[model samples]
Target: MTKAEETRTRIIQQAADLFNQQGYAGASMSDIMAATGLKKGGIYNHFASKDELAIAAFDFALEQVQKRYVRAVKGKRGSIARLKAIIYTFATAPDEVTVKGGCPLLNTAVESDDAHPVLRERAQRGMYQWRRMVHKVVQSGIDSGELQPTVNPDTVATILIATLEGSLMLTQLYGDRIHLQRAEQHLEQYVDSLQHVDNLKQQESSSR
Candidate 1:
Protein backbone atom coordinates (compact mmCIF):
# COMPACT_ATOMS: atom_id res chain seq x y z
CA MET A 1 0.00 0.00 0.00
CA THR A 2 1.01 3.55 -0.58
CA LYS A 3 2.24 5.61 2.39
CA ALA A 4 -0.91 7.66 2.46
CA GLU A 5 -3.08 4.58 2.28
CA GLU A 6 -1.19 3.01 5.14
CA THR A 7 -1.63 6.11 7.27
CA ARG A 8 -5.31 6.22 6.49
CA THR A 9 -5.70 2.58 7.48
CA ARG A 10 -3.85 3.10 10.74
CA ILE A 11 -6.12 5.98 11.61
CA ILE A 12 -9.19 3.90 10.82
CA GLN A 13 -8.02 0.96 12.93
CA GLN A 14 -7.30 3.10 15.96
CA ALA A 15 -10.43 5.13 15.56
CA ALA A 16 -12.49 1.97 15.14
CA ASP A 17 -11.30 0.64 18.47
CA LEU A 18 -11.91 3.96 20.16
CA PHE A 19 -15.40 4.26 18.78
CA ASN A 20 -16.21 0.72 19.74
CA GLN A 21 -15.00 1.37 23.27
CA GLN A 22 -16.63 4.78 23.50
CA GLY A 23 -19.86 5.79 21.80
CA TYR A 24 -19.73 8.20 18.87
CA ALA A 25 -20.59 11.15 21.05
CA GLY A 26 -18.32 10.12 23.88
CA ALA A 27 -15.24 9.79 21.71
CA SER A 28 -13.74 13.15 20.90
CA MET A 29 -11.06 14.63 18.69
CA SER A 30 -8.62 14.24 21.56
CA ASP A 31 -9.42 10.55 21.82
CA ILE A 32 -8.74 10.06 18.13
CA MET A 33 -5.58 12.08 18.39
CA ALA A 34 -4.42 10.01 21.32
CA ALA A 35 -5.39 6.71 19.69
CA THR A 36 -3.92 7.48 16.30
CA GLY A 37 -1.11 9.74 17.49
CA LEU A 38 -2.09 12.04 14.66
CA LYS A 39 -2.56 15.78 14.76
CA LYS A 40 -5.94 17.26 13.90
CA GLY A 41 -4.72 18.19 10.46
CA GLY A 42 -3.38 14.71 9.73
CA ILE A 43 -6.62 13.08 10.75
CA TYR A 44 -8.74 15.53 8.82
CA ASN A 45 -6.56 15.08 5.77
CA HIS A 46 -7.75 11.49 5.67
CA PHE A 47 -11.35 12.17 6.72
CA ALA A 48 -13.30 15.27 5.82
CA SER A 49 -14.94 15.50 9.24
CA LYS A 50 -15.46 13.66 12.53
CA ASP A 51 -18.76 12.29 11.26
CA GLU A 52 -17.06 10.85 8.21
CA LEU A 53 -14.31 9.35 10.36
CA ALA A 54 -16.86 7.78 12.69
CA ILE A 55 -18.67 6.17 9.76
CA ALA A 56 -15.43 4.80 8.37
CA ALA A 57 -14.38 3.55 11.80
CA PHE A 58 -17.68 1.76 12.28
CA ASP A 59 -17.36 0.09 8.87
CA PHE A 60 -13.86 -1.00 9.76
CA ALA A 61 -15.05 -2.54 13.02
CA LEU A 62 -17.85 -4.39 11.22
CA GLU A 63 -15.42 -5.68 8.62
CA GLN A 64 -13.18 -7.06 11.34
CA VAL A 65 -16.12 -8.90 12.89
CA GLN A 66 -17.14 -10.40 9.52
CA LYS A 67 -13.63 -11.57 8.84
CA ARG A 68 -13.40 -13.28 12.22
CA TYR A 69 -16.66 -15.12 11.66
CA VAL A 70 -15.51 -16.25 8.22
CA ARG A 71 -12.28 -17.60 9.64
CA ALA A 72 -14.13 -19.46 12.39
CA VAL A 73 -16.19 -21.46 9.87
CA LYS A 74 -13.42 -22.02 7.38
CA GLY A 75 -12.86 -25.67 6.28
CA LYS A 76 -15.93 -26.89 8.21
CA ARG A 77 -17.91 -29.04 5.80
CA GLY A 78 -21.02 -29.77 7.80
CA SER A 79 -23.54 -26.95 8.14
CA ILE A 80 -24.13 -27.77 11.80
CA ALA A 81 -20.45 -27.65 12.56
CA ARG A 82 -20.05 -24.39 10.68
CA LEU A 83 -22.92 -22.78 12.50
CA LYS A 84 -21.71 -23.97 15.88
CA ALA A 85 -18.28 -22.68 15.13
CA ILE A 86 -19.72 -19.27 14.40
CA ILE A 87 -21.58 -19.30 17.70
CA TYR A 88 -18.50 -20.21 19.66
CA THR A 89 -16.43 -17.63 17.88
CA PHE A 90 -18.85 -14.89 18.73
CA ALA A 91 -19.42 -16.12 22.24
CA THR A 92 -15.75 -15.92 23.06
CA ALA A 93 -14.17 -13.47 20.71
CA PRO A 94 -10.50 -12.72 21.27
CA ASP A 95 -9.65 -9.61 23.24
CA GLU A 96 -7.62 -8.18 20.41
CA VAL A 97 -10.51 -8.24 18.00
CA THR A 98 -13.02 -7.26 20.68
CA VAL A 99 -10.77 -4.42 21.84
CA LYS A 100 -12.32 -4.15 25.31
CA GLY A 101 -15.61 -3.12 23.69
CA GLY A 102 -17.38 -6.32 22.72
CA CYS A 103 -19.42 -6.67 19.51
CA PRO A 104 -19.10 -3.57 17.38
CA LEU A 105 -22.39 -4.10 15.58
CA LEU A 106 -24.32 -4.24 18.81
CA ASN A 107 -22.47 -1.27 20.23
CA THR A 108 -22.99 0.82 17.14
CA ALA A 109 -26.57 -0.29 16.61
CA VAL A 110 -27.68 0.64 20.12
CA GLU A 111 -25.72 3.87 20.32
CA SER A 112 -26.38 5.20 16.85
CA ASP A 113 -29.93 4.04 16.28
CA ASP A 114 -31.48 7.39 17.08
CA ALA A 115 -28.72 9.84 16.24
CA HIS A 116 -26.49 8.65 13.44
CA PRO A 117 -28.25 7.62 10.28
CA VAL A 118 -25.15 6.37 8.49
CA LEU A 119 -23.94 4.29 11.40
CA ARG A 120 -27.41 2.92 12.11
CA GLU A 121 -27.69 1.81 8.48
CA ARG A 122 -24.25 0.22 8.68
CA ALA A 123 -25.23 -1.70 11.78
CA GLN A 124 -28.45 -2.80 10.07
CA ARG A 125 -26.46 -4.07 7.11
CA GLY A 126 -24.16 -5.98 9.42
CA MET A 127 -27.15 -7.67 11.03
CA TYR A 128 -28.63 -8.54 7.64
CA GLN A 129 -25.35 -10.10 6.57
CA TRP A 130 -25.24 -12.20 9.73
CA ARG A 131 -28.80 -13.42 9.19
CA ARG A 132 -28.01 -14.27 5.59
CA MET A 133 -25.03 -16.36 6.60
CA VAL A 134 -27.04 -18.33 9.10
CA HIS A 135 -29.85 -18.84 6.60
CA LYS A 136 -27.42 -20.11 3.99
CA VAL A 137 -26.06 -22.70 6.39
CA VAL A 138 -29.54 -23.86 7.42
CA GLN A 139 -30.80 -24.06 3.84
CA SER A 140 -27.68 -25.90 2.73
CA GLY A 141 -28.13 -28.43 5.49
CA ILE A 142 -31.70 -29.05 4.41
CA ASP A 143 -30.61 -29.47 0.80
CA SER A 144 -27.90 -31.94 1.79
CA GLY A 145 -30.29 -34.16 3.73
CA GLU A 146 -28.32 -33.46 6.88
CA LEU A 147 -31.06 -31.41 8.54
CA GLN A 148 -34.80 -31.73 8.91
CA PRO A 149 -36.55 -30.82 5.71
CA THR A 150 -39.30 -29.00 7.57
CA VAL A 151 -37.01 -26.53 9.26
CA ASN A 152 -37.59 -22.85 8.51
CA PRO A 153 -34.25 -21.23 7.77
CA ASP A 154 -35.58 -17.72 8.21
CA THR A 155 -37.03 -18.40 11.64
CA VAL A 156 -33.98 -20.32 12.78
CA ALA A 157 -31.63 -17.62 11.60
CA THR A 158 -33.65 -14.84 13.17
CA ILE A 159 -33.90 -16.59 16.51
CA LEU A 160 -30.24 -17.51 16.52
CA ILE A 161 -29.08 -13.98 15.73
CA ALA A 162 -31.45 -12.35 18.17
CA THR A 163 -30.55 -14.73 20.96
CA LEU A 164 -26.85 -14.39 20.40
CA GLU A 165 -26.89 -10.60 20.16
CA GLY A 166 -29.05 -10.38 23.24
CA SER A 167 -26.66 -12.67 25.08
CA LEU A 168 -23.73 -10.50 24.15
CA MET A 169 -25.47 -7.40 25.40
CA LEU A 170 -26.31 -9.01 28.71
CA THR A 171 -22.83 -10.40 29.12
CA GLN A 172 -21.32 -6.99 28.49
CA LEU A 173 -23.68 -5.20 30.81
CA TYR A 174 -23.32 -7.65 33.69
CA GLY A 175 -19.64 -8.44 33.14
CA ASP A 176 -20.34 -12.13 33.39
CA ARG A 177 -19.19 -14.84 31.03
CA ILE A 178 -21.99 -17.22 31.93
CA HIS A 179 -24.51 -15.46 29.73
CA LEU A 180 -22.25 -15.79 26.73
CA GLN A 181 -21.39 -19.38 27.52
CA ARG A 182 -25.02 -20.31 27.95
CA ALA A 183 -25.84 -18.72 24.63
CA GLU A 184 -23.09 -20.68 22.96
CA GLN A 185 -24.22 -23.94 24.47
CA HIS A 186 -27.85 -23.36 23.54
CA LEU A 187 -26.93 -22.39 20.03
CA GLU A 188 -24.79 -25.47 19.62
CA GLN A 189 -27.67 -27.61 20.80
CA TYR A 190 -30.03 -25.87 18.43
CA VAL A 191 -27.72 -26.50 15.52
CA ASP A 192 -27.17 -30.12 16.43
CA SER A 193 -30.87 -30.72 16.92
CA LEU A 194 -31.53 -29.45 13.41
CA GLN A 195 -29.72 -32.46 11.97
CA HIS A 196 -31.57 -35.51 10.70
CA VAL A 197 -32.00 -38.37 13.14
CA ASP A 198 -29.68 -40.59 11.17
CA ASN A 199 -26.99 -37.97 11.13
CA LEU A 200 -27.41 -37.36 14.83
CA LYS A 201 -27.18 -41.05 15.53
CA GLN A 202 -24.03 -41.35 13.47
CA GLN A 203 -22.49 -38.38 15.28
CA GLU A 204 -23.43 -39.87 18.64
CA SER A 205 -21.95 -43.22 17.80
CA SER A 206 -18.80 -41.66 16.40
CA SER A 207 -18.26 -39.85 19.69
CA ARG A 208 -18.00 -43.18 21.48
Candidate 2:
Protein backbone atom coordinates (compact mmCIF):
# COMPACT_ATOMS: atom_id res chain seq x y z
CA MET A 1 0.00 0.00 0.00
CA THR A 2 1.03 3.58 -0.50
CA LYS A 3 2.42 5.59 2.41
CA ALA A 4 -0.77 7.59 2.76
CA GLU A 5 -2.95 4.50 2.86
CA GLU A 6 -0.64 2.80 5.35
CA THR A 7 -0.59 5.88 7.56
CA ARG A 8 -4.36 6.14 7.53
CA THR A 9 -4.73 2.48 8.49
CA ARG A 10 -2.24 2.89 11.29
CA ILE A 11 -4.17 5.84 12.63
CA ILE A 12 -7.43 3.92 12.56
CA GLN A 13 -5.94 0.95 14.34
CA GLN A 14 -4.51 3.13 17.07
CA ALA A 15 -7.65 5.18 17.43
CA ALA A 16 -9.79 2.07 17.58
CA ASP A 17 -7.88 0.81 20.59
CA LEU A 18 -8.02 4.20 22.21
CA PHE A 19 -11.72 4.65 21.69
CA ASN A 20 -12.44 1.15 22.80
CA GLN A 21 -10.55 1.73 26.01
CA GLN A 22 -11.86 5.25 26.48
CA GLY A 23 -15.40 6.21 25.58
CA TYR A 24 -16.23 8.85 22.95
CA ALA A 25 -16.46 11.68 25.45
CA GLY A 26 -13.47 10.42 27.34
CA ALA A 27 -11.26 10.01 24.29
CA SER A 28 -9.99 13.39 23.21
CA MET A 29 -8.33 14.52 20.02
CA SER A 30 -5.07 14.93 21.87
CA ASP A 31 -5.34 11.34 23.07
CA ILE A 32 -5.83 10.13 19.53
CA MET A 33 -2.99 12.28 18.31
CA ALA A 34 -0.73 10.89 20.99
CA ALA A 35 -1.84 7.35 20.27
CA THR A 36 -1.17 7.76 16.56
CA GLY A 37 2.01 9.72 17.09
CA LEU A 38 0.72 12.28 14.65
CA LYS A 39 0.05 15.97 15.07
CA LYS A 40 -3.46 17.44 15.03
CA GLY A 41 -3.05 18.76 11.48
CA GLY A 42 -1.71 15.47 10.19
CA ILE A 43 -4.60 13.55 11.67
CA TYR A 44 -7.14 16.11 10.44
CA ASN A 45 -5.76 15.75 6.95
CA HIS A 46 -6.89 12.12 6.99
CA PHE A 47 -10.13 12.45 8.99
CA ALA A 48 -12.48 15.39 8.57
CA SER A 49 -13.27 15.65 12.27
CA LYS A 50 -13.09 13.85 15.58
CA ASP A 51 -16.57 12.50 15.03
CA GLU A 52 -15.52 11.14 11.67
CA LEU A 53 -12.44 9.52 13.13
CA ALA A 54 -14.47 8.04 15.99
CA ILE A 55 -16.86 6.46 13.53
CA ALA A 56 -14.05 5.02 11.44
CA ALA A 57 -12.26 3.69 14.53
CA PHE A 58 -15.42 2.10 15.84
CA ASP A 59 -16.00 0.43 12.48
CA PHE A 60 -12.46 -0.89 12.47
CA ALA A 61 -12.82 -2.28 16.00
CA LEU A 62 -16.16 -3.87 15.21
CA GLU A 63 -14.73 -5.48 12.07
CA GLN A 64 -11.95 -7.09 14.07
CA VAL A 65 -14.52 -8.47 16.51
CA GLN A 66 -16.74 -9.76 13.67
CA LYS A 67 -13.76 -11.41 12.03
CA ARG A 68 -13.01 -13.17 15.32
CA TYR A 69 -16.55 -14.52 15.43
CA VAL A 70 -16.30 -15.74 11.83
CA ARG A 71 -13.03 -17.53 12.43
CA ALA A 72 -14.36 -19.09 15.61
CA VAL A 73 -17.24 -20.80 13.82
CA LYS A 74 -15.23 -21.96 10.83
CA GLY A 75 -15.27 -25.76 10.23
CA LYS A 76 -17.67 -26.22 13.13
CA ARG A 77 -20.68 -28.14 11.94
CA GLY A 78 -24.15 -28.04 13.46
CA SER A 79 -25.77 -25.14 15.26
CA ILE A 80 -24.79 -26.14 18.76
CA ALA A 81 -21.14 -26.46 17.83
CA ARG A 82 -21.11 -23.18 15.95
CA LEU A 83 -22.79 -21.32 18.77
CA LYS A 84 -20.47 -22.81 21.35
CA ALA A 85 -17.54 -21.92 19.16
CA ILE A 86 -18.77 -18.35 19.16
CA ILE A 87 -18.99 -18.34 22.94
CA TYR A 88 -15.55 -19.87 23.14
CA THR A 89 -14.17 -17.18 20.87
CA PHE A 90 -15.44 -14.45 23.16
CA ALA A 91 -14.15 -16.23 26.23
CA THR A 92 -10.67 -16.93 24.91
CA ALA A 93 -9.78 -14.11 22.56
CA PRO A 94 -6.23 -12.89 23.16
CA ASP A 95 -5.16 -9.30 23.61
CA GLU A 96 -4.04 -8.97 20.01
CA VAL A 97 -7.17 -10.45 18.50
CA THR A 98 -9.55 -8.68 20.88
CA VAL A 99 -10.06 -4.94 20.99
CA LYS A 100 -7.75 -3.63 23.70
CA GLY A 101 -10.42 -2.50 26.20
CA GLY A 102 -13.32 -4.91 25.77
CA CYS A 103 -16.23 -5.83 23.53
CA PRO A 104 -16.73 -2.91 21.17
CA LEU A 105 -20.44 -3.53 20.87
CA LEU A 106 -20.98 -3.40 24.60
CA ASN A 107 -18.68 -0.45 25.11
CA THR A 108 -20.12 1.60 22.31
CA ALA A 109 -23.69 0.77 23.16
CA VAL A 110 -23.27 1.94 26.72
CA GLU A 111 -21.29 5.02 25.85
CA SER A 112 -23.23 6.22 22.85
CA ASP A 113 -26.77 5.56 23.99
CA ASP A 114 -28.79 8.67 23.05
CA ALA A 115 -25.55 10.63 23.29
CA HIS A 116 -23.90 10.24 19.92
CA PRO A 117 -26.38 9.64 17.15
CA VAL A 118 -23.89 8.43 14.57
CA LEU A 119 -22.13 6.05 16.91
CA ARG A 120 -25.41 4.89 18.40
CA GLU A 121 -26.59 4.03 14.92
CA ARG A 122 -23.37 2.21 14.13
CA ALA A 123 -23.54 0.18 17.34
CA GLN A 124 -27.16 -0.68 16.65
CA ARG A 125 -26.23 -1.95 13.20
CA GLY A 126 -23.35 -3.97 14.58
CA MET A 127 -25.63 -5.50 17.21
CA TYR A 128 -28.23 -6.32 14.59
CA GLN A 129 -25.65 -8.14 12.50
CA TRP A 130 -24.47 -10.08 15.55
CA ARG A 131 -28.00 -11.04 16.51
CA ARG A 132 -28.69 -12.08 12.93
CA MET A 133 -25.68 -14.32 12.95
CA VAL A 134 -26.85 -16.10 16.08
CA HIS A 135 -30.40 -16.25 14.80
CA LYS A 136 -29.23 -17.89 11.59
CA VAL A 137 -27.24 -20.49 13.48
CA VAL A 138 -30.14 -21.34 15.76
CA GLN A 139 -32.55 -21.53 12.85
CA SER A 140 -30.17 -23.81 11.00
CA GLY A 141 -30.08 -26.10 13.99
CA ILE A 142 -33.85 -26.22 14.10
CA ASP A 143 -33.96 -26.91 10.36
CA SER A 144 -31.50 -29.77 10.67
CA GLY A 145 -33.48 -31.23 13.55
CA GLU A 146 -30.48 -30.96 15.81
CA LEU A 147 -32.31 -28.41 17.89
CA GLN A 148 -35.93 -28.78 18.95
CA PRO A 149 -38.35 -27.48 16.36
CA THR A 150 -40.23 -25.51 18.97
CA VAL A 151 -37.25 -23.43 19.93
CA ASN A 152 -37.34 -19.78 18.91
CA PRO A 153 -34.21 -18.61 17.15
CA ASP A 154 -34.91 -15.00 18.06
CA THR A 155 -35.21 -15.85 21.73
CA VAL A 156 -32.10 -17.97 21.64
CA ALA A 157 -30.18 -15.21 19.94
CA THR A 158 -31.32 -12.68 22.52
CA ILE A 159 -30.41 -14.94 25.40
CA LEU A 160 -27.04 -15.80 23.99
CA ILE A 161 -26.14 -12.19 23.29
CA ALA A 162 -27.46 -10.95 26.60
CA THR A 163 -25.77 -13.61 28.66
CA LEU A 164 -22.45 -13.30 26.88
CA GLU A 165 -22.38 -9.51 26.82
CA GLY A 166 -23.50 -9.20 30.41
CA SER A 167 -20.92 -11.69 31.51
CA LEU A 168 -18.34 -9.78 29.52
CA MET A 169 -19.20 -6.62 31.41
CA LEU A 170 -18.75 -8.40 34.69
CA THR A 171 -15.48 -9.83 33.51
CA GLN A 172 -14.14 -6.46 32.59
CA LEU A 173 -15.48 -4.76 35.69
CA TYR A 174 -13.76 -7.21 38.01
CA GLY A 175 -10.63 -7.86 35.94
CA ASP A 176 -11.31 -11.57 36.19
CA ARG A 177 -11.85 -14.15 33.49
CA ILE A 178 -13.97 -16.30 35.80
CA HIS A 179 -17.09 -14.38 34.83
CA LEU A 180 -16.53 -15.27 31.20
CA GLN A 181 -15.73 -18.85 32.12
CA ARG A 182 -19.00 -19.13 33.98
CA ALA A 183 -20.80 -17.64 31.03
CA GLU A 184 -19.23 -20.21 28.73
CA GLN A 185 -20.29 -23.05 30.96
CA HIS A 186 -23.81 -21.75 31.31
CA LEU A 187 -24.13 -21.19 27.56
CA GLU A 188 -22.86 -24.68 26.81
CA GLN A 189 -25.55 -26.14 29.01
CA TYR A 190 -28.12 -23.82 27.48
CA VAL A 191 -27.12 -24.82 23.99
CA ASP A 192 -27.16 -28.47 24.97
CA SER A 193 -30.66 -28.04 26.33
CA LEU A 194 -31.78 -26.89 22.89
CA GLN A 195 -30.73 -30.19 21.34
CA HIS A 196 -33.54 -32.34 20.00
CA VAL A 197 -34.36 -35.48 21.96
CA ASP A 198 -33.33 -37.67 19.04
CA ASN A 199 -30.05 -35.86 18.68
CA LEU A 200 -29.32 -36.34 22.36
CA LYS A 201 -30.21 -40.00 22.14
CA GLN A 202 -27.99 -40.42 19.12
CA GLN A 203 -25.08 -38.98 21.03
CA GLU A 204 -25.87 -41.22 24.02
CA SER A 205 -25.99 -44.28 21.78
CA SER A 206 -22.76 -43.35 20.02
CA SER A 207 -21.01 -43.00 23.35
CA ARG A 208 -22.07 -46.50 24.44
Candidate 3:
Protein backbone atom coordinates (compact mmCIF):
# COMPACT_ATOMS: atom_id res chain seq x y z
CA MET A 1 0.00 0.00 0.00
CA THR A 2 1.07 3.57 -0.55
CA LYS A 3 2.31 5.53 2.47
CA ALA A 4 -0.80 7.69 2.39
CA GLU A 5 -3.05 4.67 2.26
CA GLU A 6 -1.15 3.09 5.16
CA THR A 7 -1.52 6.28 7.18
CA ARG A 8 -5.22 6.41 6.42
CA THR A 9 -5.65 2.82 7.55
CA ARG A 10 -3.69 3.46 10.70
CA ILE A 11 -5.84 6.49 11.48
CA ILE A 12 -9.00 4.46 10.97
CA GLN A 13 -7.84 1.62 13.19
CA GLN A 14 -6.78 3.93 15.98
CA ALA A 15 -9.89 6.06 15.70
CA ALA A 16 -12.05 2.93 15.72
CA ASP A 17 -10.66 1.81 19.05
CA LEU A 18 -11.00 5.31 20.43
CA PHE A 19 -14.59 5.57 19.34
CA ASN A 20 -15.39 2.17 20.70
CA GLN A 21 -14.05 3.05 24.11
CA GLN A 22 -15.23 6.63 24.03
CA GLY A 23 -18.52 7.49 22.43
CA TYR A 24 -18.60 9.61 19.27
CA ALA A 25 -19.27 12.83 21.14
CA GLY A 26 -16.92 11.83 23.90
CA ALA A 27 -13.98 11.55 21.50
CA SER A 28 -12.52 14.85 20.33
CA MET A 29 -10.21 15.78 17.49
CA SER A 30 -7.39 16.14 19.96
CA ASP A 31 -8.12 12.65 21.28
CA ILE A 32 -8.04 11.31 17.73
CA MET A 33 -4.88 13.20 17.06
CA ALA A 34 -3.40 11.64 20.17
CA ALA A 35 -4.54 8.20 19.12
CA THR A 36 -3.30 8.57 15.55
CA GLY A 37 -0.27 10.68 16.52
CA LEU A 38 -1.25 13.00 13.67
CA LYS A 39 -1.50 16.76 13.63
CA LYS A 40 -4.78 18.50 12.79
CA GLY A 41 -3.66 19.08 9.24
CA GLY A 42 -2.62 15.46 8.79
CA ILE A 43 -6.00 14.25 10.03
CA TYR A 44 -7.90 16.69 7.84
CA ASN A 45 -5.84 15.61 4.88
CA HIS A 46 -7.24 12.09 5.31
CA PHE A 47 -10.71 13.03 6.58
CA ALA A 48 -12.68 16.16 5.96
CA SER A 49 -14.18 16.29 9.44
CA LYS A 50 -14.76 14.34 12.61
CA ASP A 51 -18.06 13.13 11.22
CA GLU A 52 -16.38 11.62 8.17
CA LEU A 53 -13.64 10.14 10.28
CA ALA A 54 -16.25 8.62 12.58
CA ILE A 55 -17.98 6.91 9.71
CA ALA A 56 -14.74 5.48 8.41
CA ALA A 57 -13.63 4.45 11.91
CA PHE A 58 -16.92 2.72 12.57
CA ASP A 59 -16.69 0.87 9.28
CA PHE A 60 -13.21 -0.27 10.16
CA ALA A 61 -14.33 -1.52 13.58
CA LEU A 62 -17.36 -3.32 12.19
CA GLU A 63 -15.27 -4.89 9.45
CA GLN A 64 -12.74 -6.09 11.96
CA VAL A 65 -15.47 -7.78 14.01
CA GLN A 66 -16.99 -9.33 10.88
CA LYS A 67 -13.62 -10.73 9.89
CA ARG A 68 -13.31 -12.30 13.32
CA TYR A 69 -16.72 -13.91 12.88
CA VAL A 70 -15.70 -15.28 9.49
CA ARG A 71 -12.54 -16.77 10.94
CA ALA A 72 -14.45 -18.40 13.76
CA VAL A 73 -16.99 -20.01 11.44
CA LYS A 74 -14.53 -20.99 8.72
CA GLY A 75 -14.11 -24.75 8.05
CA LYS A 76 -17.09 -25.58 10.26
CA ARG A 77 -19.61 -27.88 8.61
CA GLY A 78 -23.36 -27.77 8.93
CA SER A 79 -25.48 -24.74 9.76
CA ILE A 80 -25.79 -25.84 13.36
CA ALA A 81 -22.02 -25.94 13.85
CA ARG A 82 -21.59 -22.66 12.03
CA LEU A 83 -24.30 -20.98 14.09
CA LYS A 84 -22.84 -22.24 17.32
CA ALA A 85 -19.42 -21.08 16.16
CA ILE A 86 -20.79 -17.56 15.86
CA ILE A 87 -22.06 -17.62 19.41
CA TYR A 88 -18.80 -19.05 20.70
CA THR A 89 -16.86 -16.55 18.72
CA PHE A 90 -18.67 -13.52 20.10
CA ALA A 91 -18.30 -14.88 23.59
CA THR A 92 -14.53 -14.66 23.21
CA ALA A 93 -13.63 -12.70 20.12
CA PRO A 94 -10.17 -11.27 19.59
CA ASP A 95 -11.46 -7.79 18.87
CA GLU A 96 -13.44 -7.70 22.09
CA VAL A 97 -10.33 -8.83 23.94
CA THR A 98 -8.24 -6.13 22.35
CA VAL A 99 -10.83 -3.38 22.55
CA LYS A 100 -11.63 -4.14 26.20
CA GLY A 101 -14.98 -2.51 25.55
CA GLY A 102 -17.51 -4.66 23.71
CA CYS A 103 -18.95 -5.30 20.29
CA PRO A 104 -18.23 -2.25 18.13
CA LEU A 105 -21.58 -2.57 16.38
CA LEU A 106 -23.42 -2.62 19.67
CA ASN A 107 -21.31 0.21 21.03
CA THR A 108 -21.93 2.32 17.98
CA ALA A 109 -25.61 1.51 17.93
CA VAL A 110 -26.14 2.62 21.50
CA GLU A 111 -23.93 5.69 21.32
CA SER A 112 -25.15 6.89 17.97
CA ASP A 113 -28.84 6.56 18.77
CA ASP A 114 -30.85 9.63 17.66
CA ALA A 115 -27.53 11.26 16.90
CA HIS A 116 -24.90 10.92 14.24
CA PRO A 117 -27.30 9.94 11.51
CA VAL A 118 -24.71 8.48 9.18
CA LEU A 119 -22.97 6.44 11.86
CA ARG A 120 -26.32 5.30 13.22
CA GLU A 121 -27.37 4.13 9.78
CA ARG A 122 -24.14 2.26 9.39
CA ALA A 123 -24.75 0.39 12.63
CA GLN A 124 -28.33 -0.33 11.64
CA ARG A 125 -27.13 -1.66 8.32
CA GLY A 126 -24.60 -3.88 10.02
CA MET A 127 -27.37 -5.30 12.22
CA TYR A 128 -29.65 -6.02 9.27
CA GLN A 129 -26.83 -7.73 7.39
CA TRP A 130 -26.02 -9.81 10.45
CA ARG A 131 -29.64 -10.86 10.81
CA ARG A 132 -29.68 -11.87 7.16
CA MET A 133 -26.54 -13.96 7.53
CA VAL A 134 -28.01 -15.83 10.49
CA HIS A 135 -31.32 -16.26 8.73
CA LYS A 136 -29.59 -17.74 5.69
CA VAL A 137 -27.77 -20.28 7.82
CA VAL A 138 -30.95 -21.34 9.57
CA GLN A 139 -32.82 -21.60 6.26
CA SER A 140 -30.01 -23.63 4.78
CA GLY A 141 -30.21 -26.05 7.70
CA ILE A 142 -33.91 -26.51 7.11
CA ASP A 143 -33.36 -27.10 3.41
CA SER A 144 -30.70 -29.71 4.13
CA GLY A 145 -33.01 -31.49 6.55
CA GLU A 146 -30.63 -30.89 9.42
CA LEU A 147 -33.18 -28.70 11.19
CA GLN A 148 -36.90 -28.97 11.70
CA PRO A 149 -39.02 -27.82 8.80
CA THR A 150 -41.19 -25.69 11.02
CA VAL A 151 -38.30 -23.61 12.29
CA ASN A 152 -38.53 -19.94 11.30
CA PRO A 153 -35.18 -18.61 10.20
CA ASP A 154 -36.19 -15.01 10.72
CA THR A 155 -37.36 -15.64 14.24
CA VAL A 156 -34.29 -17.65 15.09
CA ALA A 157 -32.01 -14.98 13.69
CA THR A 158 -33.77 -12.24 15.64
CA ILE A 159 -33.60 -14.22 18.84
CA LEU A 160 -29.94 -15.09 18.41
CA ILE A 161 -28.95 -11.50 17.72
CA ALA A 162 -31.06 -10.09 20.50
CA THR A 163 -29.94 -12.60 23.06
CA LEU A 164 -26.30 -12.28 22.11
CA GLU A 165 -26.34 -8.49 22.10
CA GLY A 166 -28.31 -8.31 25.34
CA SER A 167 -25.93 -10.72 26.99
CA LEU A 168 -22.96 -8.77 25.78
CA MET A 169 -24.33 -5.57 27.29
CA LEU A 170 -25.00 -7.26 30.60
CA THR A 171 -21.63 -8.94 30.54
CA GLN A 172 -19.86 -5.67 30.00
CA LEU A 173 -21.96 -3.88 32.58
CA TYR A 174 -21.22 -6.43 35.27
CA GLY A 175 -17.72 -7.26 34.10
CA ASP A 176 -18.75 -10.89 34.32
CA ARG A 177 -18.02 -13.41 31.63
CA ILE A 178 -20.75 -15.68 32.90
CA HIS A 179 -23.38 -13.52 31.28
CA LEU A 180 -21.89 -14.20 27.86
CA GLN A 181 -21.18 -17.83 28.71
CA ARG A 182 -24.77 -18.36 29.74
CA ALA A 183 -25.97 -16.72 26.57
CA GLU A 184 -23.72 -19.01 24.56
CA GLN A 185 -25.08 -22.08 26.33
CA HIS A 186 -28.65 -20.99 25.82
CA LEU A 187 -28.07 -20.19 22.16
CA GLU A 188 -26.47 -23.59 21.71
CA GLN A 189 -29.52 -25.20 23.23
CA TYR A 190 -31.77 -23.14 20.97
CA VAL A 191 -29.87 -24.37 17.94
CA ASP A 192 -29.87 -27.93 19.24
CA SER A 193 -33.61 -27.72 19.71
CA LEU A 194 -33.92 -27.06 15.99
CA GLN A 195 -32.06 -30.18 15.01
CA HIS A 196 -33.94 -32.93 13.19
CA VAL A 197 -35.32 -35.72 15.32
CA ASP A 198 -32.84 -38.28 14.08
CA ASN A 199 -29.91 -35.96 14.60
CA LEU A 200 -31.10 -35.09 18.08
CA LYS A 201 -31.53 -38.74 18.93
CA GLN A 202 -28.10 -39.55 17.60
CA GLN A 203 -26.54 -36.80 19.70
CA GLU A 204 -28.40 -38.00 22.76
CA SER A 205 -27.30 -41.56 22.24
CA SER A 206 -23.70 -40.62 21.57
CA SER A 207 -23.51 -38.69 24.84
CA ARG A 208 -24.51 -41.79 26.76
Task: Highest TM-score: give the candidate number.
Answer: 2
Candidate 2 deviant stretches above 4 angstroms:
94-96
Q: Between prediction 1 and prediction 2, which has the larger TM-score?
A: 2
TM-score of 1: 0.93
Better of 2 and 3 by lDDT: 2
State how far residue 33 of model 3 sits from its true place (Å): 1.0
lDDT of 2 by residue, 146-193 (tens): 999999999998999999999889988888889889999999999999
- Tens digits of per-residue lDDT for model 1, 1-208: 9999999999988898898899889999999999999999999999999999999988888888889888889999988889888888888783445455888888988898667888888888998999999999999999998999989999998888888889988887898888889988888888877899888888789999
Clashing pairs in 3: none
Over the full model, what C-alpha lDDT does candidate 1 score relative to the true structure? 0.88
Report the lDDT of model 1 for residue 163: 86
Question: What does candidate 2 score on TM?
Answer: 0.97
Give candidate 1's error at residue 203 in angstroms. 3.8
Worst lDDT run of 10 residues, candidate 2, spans 90-99
The root-mean-square deviation over C-alpha atoms between each candidate and the true structure, in angstroms, is 1.7, 1.1, 1.8
TM-scores, each model vs. reference: 0.93, 0.97, 0.93
* Candidate 3 per-residue C-alpha lDDT over 1-208 given as tens digits, one digit per residue, 9 for 90 to 100: 9999999999998988898989889999999989999999999999999999989988888887788878877898999999999898887763356453578888988888676889889999999888988998899999998999999999999899999999989888887878888999999999999999987888789999
